[model samples]
Target: MGKEFIELFEQWADHYDETVTGHDLEYKEVFRHYEAILAEVAKRTFGHVIEFGPGTGNLTEELLKRGRTVTAFEPSPAMRNLAQEKIGNRAEIKEGDFLSFEFKKSVQSIVSSYAFHHLTDKEKAEAIAAYGNILESGGKIVFADTMYESVEAYKQAIKDASEKGFHNLAEDLEREYYTTIPILKEMLEANHFTVSFEKMNDFVWIMEALKK
Candidate 1:
């Protein structure tokens, strides 16, 4: 799975930020929201921040600018190369997916921008629990990603996409599992983390949770 996306993203590394910014409907207006989440984390800790899928270093650059060191879980070679070029020594770039990646040490905060949607439902829960294991007490998590309101809403979205002649897009959505804020809140709370949510738009949300 990681190998396949790595090869696919290797081709997109150069133009990722530009193309995804305007072309991806679910991602439109997400940059500002990401910055807000980063700022929230910045207010909490000055320690290293763990980031999953730091593609092209858009959010990585922001975290570095705020003086937060980043440990990136990025699997794409080309993407990692570009991110390194953009971020320099400000980040620790590790090439792997979140499911297999482990923290070498405790970090005060964990963040992912538009990356969590890549995980399946079961994987997402595991990842959330793993996040708790890696963080110190009161450690913060700021996740900004494309999310549906519910599984049912995702189903309706697919139906609407199909009706609008986006058959291929509908199929893609069916294959990938995204999340809703409420469901994410439940998962976090079940892991003993307190949670809150802020929306960027209809699909993008900033989910903030703190480890208890």
Candidate 2:
């Protein structure tokens, strides 16, 4: 488990969603925006599902309504509690980090939102490989997250953040980082995932990588 992340997210559990959307002006709609895409995926995908980080169970709520049995790996106890309260026994909750958590059974797809970027490039690769390992053939990873164009773009965003009165947020964004889509594509491809997109833009993306 990532001790640092555990503490950080626990502290942020209450305002996590607001914090993310509020600070990233352009992506405030990402949460609501991803519903339709994931809904489309649930219709097309099959078997059991797993979600990496299910903050307030917003997406989890949608998944349950669509009849997909979901298991969520959310490390923050507070967030997990919030999700538990939000969705009850509708979905299984695993209070652990994705990297440390074990996949007990094979699943059809692994889904996530705004969570993968928490990992470094190497860890992202490892997590992708883990998803591949647990999924049955044809099973995939469907996720939406911040995908920057370059290191410079993220750096510049920091300046823009300060100019917008988000000094603390700018500092935080400065700490957060990402790997470009091309690089993420190569990593997924190398791990035997054929990548596709449900949504694509300069800063964020909703992607599907089918395991081969």
Candidate 3:
């Protein structure tokens, strides 16, 4: 699962909002158009939704605004607390990760933002497979996160970040499980999902996968 990064998220909980708002220079490009990205994901989601790594609940808020019922999971206690405080009782925010969660209701969509990179490629595939089992035909998975077009692009990103004196960003790019689009496309298709992607920023892309 993605719970391995829970400690980082716990320490980042308080300042996560600030980072997404472009206040952090190193991550500014990574979180560019943050609000718009959330809105776009929310717009594409429908009916009962399962949201992974809700973080501070920014996307959850967007989904609620659109009248979508949301069931969210977060591995970090600090992040989960902030999300609950921000969202109140409107949606349930549980202690879970992408590969470990419980849901009984019929879910029409799954949504997440800036959080999936914590899982390695194999784990990502596992999570998608689980979603494939959980959702019916026509169910959707909308996720906005940092993904590259190719392996070269991913390496160049780390290099570019380093040249820009963004050591932290470069290290994060190297440390995290950030992957390329082709691999994700293959995983989605293997799980019987027809997927499309749209660029959201220099470092972010929106993956909209529909169960087939």
Best by TM-score: 3
Q: Write the residue-wise lDDT of candidate 3 on 1-212 in tens digits.
A: 46667778888999999999989999998888999999999999889999999999999999999999899998998999999999999999999989999887668999889889999999999999999988878999999999999999999999999999999999999999999999999999998999999999999999999999
What TM-score goes with each of the models? Answer: 0.84, 0.85, 0.98
Off by over 4 Å in 1: 1-4, 23-46, 163-171
> Model 2: what TM-score?
0.85
lDDT of 2 by residue, 106-188 (tens): 99988887777778788888888888889999998887777765667777867876887867656656566456778788889
| lDDT of model 3 at position 72 | 95
Highest lDDT: give the candidate number: 3
lDDT for every model? 0.75, 0.74, 0.93
The lDDT of model 1 is 0.75
lDDT of 2: 0.74
Candidate 2 pairs with clashing backbones: none
Runs in model 3 with CA error above 4 Å? none
Cα lDDT tens digits for candidate 1, 63-104: 777788778889888888888888888777887877878667
Instruction: Give per-residue lDDT, candidate 2, residue 23.
Output: 55
